[model samples]
Target chain A: MILRTLRLHRFKWLLLTGYLPLSLLAAALVGDPVRWEDVHWLDVFGEGGGALMVLTWSLLILGSRPAGTVSNLLFIGLSLILVTLWQDNLDEFWTIPDAQLWDTWLENIPMPVGMAVLTLGLVRWYEEQRVLMAQLSQRERFMREHRSIDPVTRLASADYLNQQLAIELRRARRECSPVSLMMLDLDGFDLINRRFGAHEGDRLLQAVTELLLLNLRDGDLLCRYAADRFAIMLPQTSEAMADLIASELTSAIRHFAYRSSKEGERVTVTASAGVALALSASPEELMQRANRALSEAKQTGSGCHAMAG
Target chain B: MQWRDDSLEATWRSPDTPHLPAHHHPALLIELAHARGIPEHRLLRHTGLFPEDMRRGEAMLSDRQYRRLIGNILEYDTGGELALVWGRQSLPGHYGPPSTQIHNAPNLAEALNCLHHWRHQLSPLLTPLWWHNRQWCYLLWTTAGAGRRGPFLVPAAMAAVYGLARHRLARSLDWHFLFAAPRPTSPQPYEVNLGPTVRFGAGVDMVVLPVEDLYEPWPGRSQTAFTAAAHEAERVPALNGAGPTLPEVVYQSLAAHPETPAGLDDTAGALGLSPSSLKRHLRDYDSRFQALYDEVRLHHSLYLHQVMGLSMEGIAERLSHGDRANFRRSFRRWTGLSPAQYQRLLPE
Candidate 1:
């Protein structure tokens, strides 16, 4: 993945490489080799270390991020800072002519200028993250772990749900608030796979995830608990309120007209949900209760069932 | 003389015997992975086969080749749902008249009987053996040279059976699943596909169902179609090709005389073979009589202790262990944990 990203920034890589020769020529033209006694090993160590760290940061940004405004800005600012630090480290080895102050200006000017550009890049990055966080609100709660995201549905996986449930339960306990979990499963999902194919089934899951996210409140978190089953974590929700939300979710999915991309046939599905409100039960027990209630709902052909702990 | 045919069956055909039709399980698996965007070559890599092999009119896969195919698919599988999904699509599948026989059964009980009777054709990997007590019926899954692929194959086979049962009944039946394997990191597939009443790390792999549920008539039963399908199925040879493998036969004999604890000589005599011949036949399937015996004994002791609610001393006495201490020692050796520790690992 990193190699692919780096391949996309060939021009940026060329610019980064050009810095080496440019700095070398500038230092060699107007500077004399310093005496061995005059060399400050301590200063070289500090400045060289800073330059190396900044280079690493720039490479990481180039490798992980797309060639967007934020990445370009961050890359440019770090490169500038790295160039200045490289100049400072070079001064310990080369003694510049007294009349030539360009080397001194090179060390002094770019550092502060780079700081300003870096600040601007950080500000833009913060704004970009806010928009992404809003979009991911349904998938994640207070934590973000990329590994926990499901590849097919782009939703948090069951492991993430377990971790978030633990935190939510603890917070609810301390704050004396109710936290409810609703387990939702699409009815006869296997039939859909058998009819169309698993690819269509995966697309249907992604569409259903979107539909569920649309119906959820701002604070509600939706996770893909497993294949064809999803879990919603609702804080400060009572059992009655949970049942209401569960029914809304069921009705939303029931009405969704998912078109199969292969055949373009309109396939509709209903969902069964089981809601459980936390009292003092452990997270595992609470999840079990919700899953059992889901089984009950499925058996009885109910839209939703609530179990109060 | 009685053992001549059995011994010959074992020696002539090993795990390398081409028992499974390429179009059935192998094709179904390839289709599933292909739908999920996995290329056919990747799923068939190192399995010494090609996508075209499945299309050949009468291509077949030996147990070793099928195991390799399963291992390859599992390498690309995440979250462990592939096997369950495969199982769901497996049964009532197009093989021959047996699929029709299973599909046209009168009830879940008859459908299950068809699966058991035609297992050599339908489920060649694991042999399904069922028996019922007064209240509940137990469907036991015994391996037939599954080797290292047992874990993956069992769930898929179980899911196939469970999925068919649900489809026939149009509702989830009240059943409890027991697996002799450890619990997976994610149990959602097992719970979602097979319902939530599942237990792992049990001493046996089986499913327990209420006897009443078994006899409940499915809505789509057609007596004429069922009888016709059965009559047609009889003309087709058992898909295991040669016959029952040695491991399955050994498992049956050991399971039949669980309390008596048959010695190698006794079992060999029962099968009409000398002890060395029986031993060599089992080795062909990558199995041993002692391993099969230990498995049966372990299943019996755990069942008595956990399911039947027998105490340690009572179980030891029933199994003919002289004392609780010897039973404890044997149990530890079998499961790597004391009986109490094993129980602790079990789900409530």
Candidate 2:
């Protein structure tokens, strides 16, 4: 960990260490010697302590982060202040000649300048934090909703659908693999709920979900896109394969005899579907394209429609 | 200290329902706002909470409302390491009664036990599950459906434990943290705060500790104070069915086997129950064990293969498959591509 930090802030550390030799040379040239009787242990502790604290803070910031603009600013500022503190603390043990002005310049110059740079670094850090929080929020939302289930159909929810689609699209882009989405909508589902009770409609939805799941390929993720609309995410599937699945789904739904528990009556439900190959990053956009095709298919009264976008 | 004294009277709430005031420490909220140089009124806006509520018990808001406040804070502020900052500032006193009991335990084991027993009172989010052999102790943490707050919650929980341990035992204890999530781009804050031992993309969010660490006594351990604290802990509201639910048990069982799945009979035997009894328990939870098993398998495979970067054979061996060929076939059937092909699809 220390090694990583050293590497991250090598320039700052080098600059700080470079002063050690200069200080030693200046002390040697001064020729004034310190006596045991003249030593102020209290001043040594106070000045030395301040230098050590600054060093610790610098190490902490450097160790935790990689080289970035904010980190660079912080390290530079901290090092500047650290040098000033260290040189002032050294005056207690060694004497510099009264004629030499370098020590006084070192003691006074870096204080306000260091503080100004540090203030700038802190301001940048605050801005950087806002971006991180947005990213954090997105990450947490992704984790929570990644495996969300639709209570009605016992299928994956729209959130999960979008997540999977994003993954599939990235993979598709990488491997040049074809992934497809099938959007299926039950025809006039509200009419069924109005005619029968909502409970009966719910049972029909469940039965339809079961039928869809049974018909789906092992790799397919069937998701509830919205009320009465289902989405199937098919990975490693060709355009031809997607068309076959869409037609199969349309026929299967048409053949589905959903019985209402109240009247024990058989209700035949027909569905229109639109299939699209994965082409974009935005799951919403993909869904919209599929919906448009479905709406067009509905106008023609066709059971299924396939489009490449 | 005065801010704490003033805010301490605000009621500690159960986050189980959306109705209660989600935060236990309003002072922390004020401090977070203050750090950002935001006004207290602006911070409390839409939360139906006032900073004055910390003094006089008037500001009460639902979980939904509190979440909105968090959302607002997040929206305006420049990106900062909010979770680490929050964790660093988390004092045990902010957690109220249950925290006192957890803090005063004679040793780590008793402290952990106290924490486990009173967890529902502190927060409904984290439930620490303990598993140990003779040498090492494993405390696996599972979430109680705390969705979007998970990013903050995980680190915050770690910070709390870290602070408590440091205060009580000094540098006497040795432990490392493991998280199931993939490593983030900026791991510096986590590395700095959690030290070098933090591992991401691991099996579970767990704390690995030597068995000896549990026996080390806490400074200022008192039996009298602990007993009183525990007594007060009991007054916190608990769910009707206090024991582990069947789904939770099944999830644990599945989580235990990332490479090899345990059969129904085997899992039942492991639980010291018959297969029928296991089935009955699962039925009471309104879910089939098979469905739960599939869910766990799907989630585990995604983590191990995608995040942990394990080979298909390695995953198969972990899942306990005898034949690599059989595993390959099953993998293909599940994903519509061979393991190697699927791997090629992922970025390096």
Compare the candidates by lDDT and give the number of the best one: 1
B59-85 per-residue lDDT for model 2 (tens digits): 444444655566666665322244544
Give lDDT tens digits, candidate 1, residues B149-188. Answer: 7778788878888888887787767788877778888788
DockQ scores for all predicted structures = 0.32, 0.01
Error of 2 at A256 (Å): 82
Which whole-number lDDT from 0 to 100 does residue A305 have in model 2?
A: 62
lDDT of 2: 0.64
Go through the candidates in order and give each one's C-alpha lDDT.
0.78, 0.64
lDDT of 2 by residue, A213-271 (tens): 77887667777765567788888898888889899888999987778897889887888
TM-score of B-chain for each predicted structure, in order: 0.83, 0.61
Each prediction's TM-score versus the true structure = 0.79, 0.38
Q: Which stretches of candidate 2 lie over 4 Å from their true place?
A: A1-309, B1-23, B26-30, B38-45, B58-62, B66-80, B88-91, B172-174, B236-348
lDDT tens string, model 1, A38-77?
8999998999999999999888878988889998889878
